[model samples]
Target: MPKLIKDGRVVDDQWQGEILQPEQIPESPAAPVAVQLEPGQGPATIPCALSNLGLVTIFFPAFTDGRCFSYARELRESGYTGEIRATGHFIRDQLFYLQRCGFNAFQFAEEVDLDACLASLSDFSESYQAAVDQPEPLFLRR
Candidate 1:
């Protein structure tokens, strides 16, 4: 089983859903439905059906591709209350920002030290801008 950082802890991924491509929806999906969103895919591609999914796994082909960061924010802005998991290629340094963008779960493609990654999540005690997790910007909070 794959390990993931969920809700601030490293644990075995309990997702039983099958992450299928946008067009591969089964007539009767036995398990919960999860969508695999690629780097170039628009967050709106699954807009109308956000509530129907059990999870939305956004793949970061590389750490340099920051598009997934926007996708996670957009998904949250669009009212996707379910889990928005960041998987593939992202580094631990981005974890804090990823969480600010509403990514509650993370699964790295590489073999990184989970403990170090978990610690990195708290690298900063606060953020300056408004985000999915923090609606009020720092100025507004002051």
Candidate 2:
């Protein structure tokens, strides 16, 4: 089993997938679920469905394409309160930004130095703007 460092602790990771079809996700309580989006797919079409399924993992097929980041923020803004995750080709440097964008968990493509990446979450003690996960928006901090 792969290990993920979440909330500063290392633990076994579990994730379920939500197929594009509406009927694919079941109601039973299960592992955190992941949702995959093809290029150009609109977030509006799927967020509601993913939210209803409980935990959700959003995949970014490539690191350069950032549409998923916007999708995650929009999901949070629209009132989806479950766990949001980032998976696939994600880099350690992207963690803080992903967190700011509302991704609470990440599944990188390869084994990483978990401790180093976890430390990077707070590499900067301050931020300039409020993000989905930070309600105060960094600018309001005194």
Candidate 3:
């Protein structure tokens, strides 16, 4: 099984899902479930019909596309509390930023070093702007 950096550690990924036709969703997934949504597919992609999902993995076709950041935050702010993951083409340098955007887990492409990405999560001790992880911006604390 492929390992993932979840909650800051490497763990066996149990969630599974096949790319179903636009009309199909696993009626009752056996274990934890994951749903893949492309950036700009919009938050409604995770509508009530798939509320049982344990994870939502957002696809980043390119590092330059930042829509996924907002997608994850919107899911959080809208109250879908399951794990929000960023996968594909993302770089280790953006791990902190991704986490701040409400992504609790990350599944980078196999070419990236998982260990390095895990360490990147702690590369910074603080952030200044408001984010899902820290709703209050740094200036507000002054």
Candidate 4:
């Protein structure tokens, strides 16, 4: 079974249906399916087409590939309200930033110390700008 990190805790994924195998995510029967973007794939008709589907998962392939990061942010800006998940070579350190960019969940490669990683979610004491989820960011609180 795959492990999903939620609320800073590692737990078994309970989604019904065939478990998503390694490098395998089924077509989004819910409408928009998850899309995997490779390096130099170039953004074009695919993203637009998938956006209309519903739920889409933008793969990173590797943490070093920054293209997917941009793709994800663009998708949200384009008005994609569906779920956008980050998979492959993703670490807890990138969670908050990813979330801010519209990634709601993460499929980590291995079982991590949930409690420890969760601590990193709010490493900074505060923030100066509003994020997608946090309207006032952190520092602007009264």
Question: Which candidate leads the pack in lDDT?
Answer: 1
Q: For residues 33-96, what per-residue lDDT tens digits would candidate 4 score against the true structure?
A: 4455444652343524444444445566687877777777776776776666667777778877
Per-residue error (Å), model 2, residue 100: 0.6
| Stretches of candidate 4 exceeding 4 Å from the true structure | 6-32, 42-51, 129-131, 134-142
TM-score of each model, in listed order: 0.91, 0.78, 0.84, 0.64
The lDDT of model 3 is: 0.77
Instruction: Kindly report which residue pairs in candidate 1 clash with one another.
Output: none
Winner by lDDT between candidate 3 and candidate 1: 1
Tens digits of lDDT, candidate 1, 23-140:
6765455555888887878666663367677888999999889889899999899888988899899999999999999999999999988877899888898889999988999999
lDDT of 3 at 2: 82
Task: Identify the leading candidate in terms of TM-score.
Answer: 1
Give me the displacement of residue 77 in model 4, in angstroms.
0.5
Candidate 3 minimal-lDDT segment of 10 residues: 17-26
Of the candidates numbered 3 and 4, which has the greater lDDT value? 3
Clashes (candidate 1):
0
Q: Mark the regions of model 1 whose C-alpha exceeds 4 Å error after superposition.
A: 26-32
Q: Model 1 — TM-score against the truth? A: 0.91
lDDT of 3 at 56: 82
Off by over 4 Å in 2: 16-34, 47-51
User: Cα deviation in Å at residue 111, candidate 4?
Assistant: 3.4
How are the candidates ranked when ordered by TM-score, highest leading?
Answer: 1, 3, 2, 4
Which 10-residue span in candidate 2 carries the lowest summed lDDT? 16-25
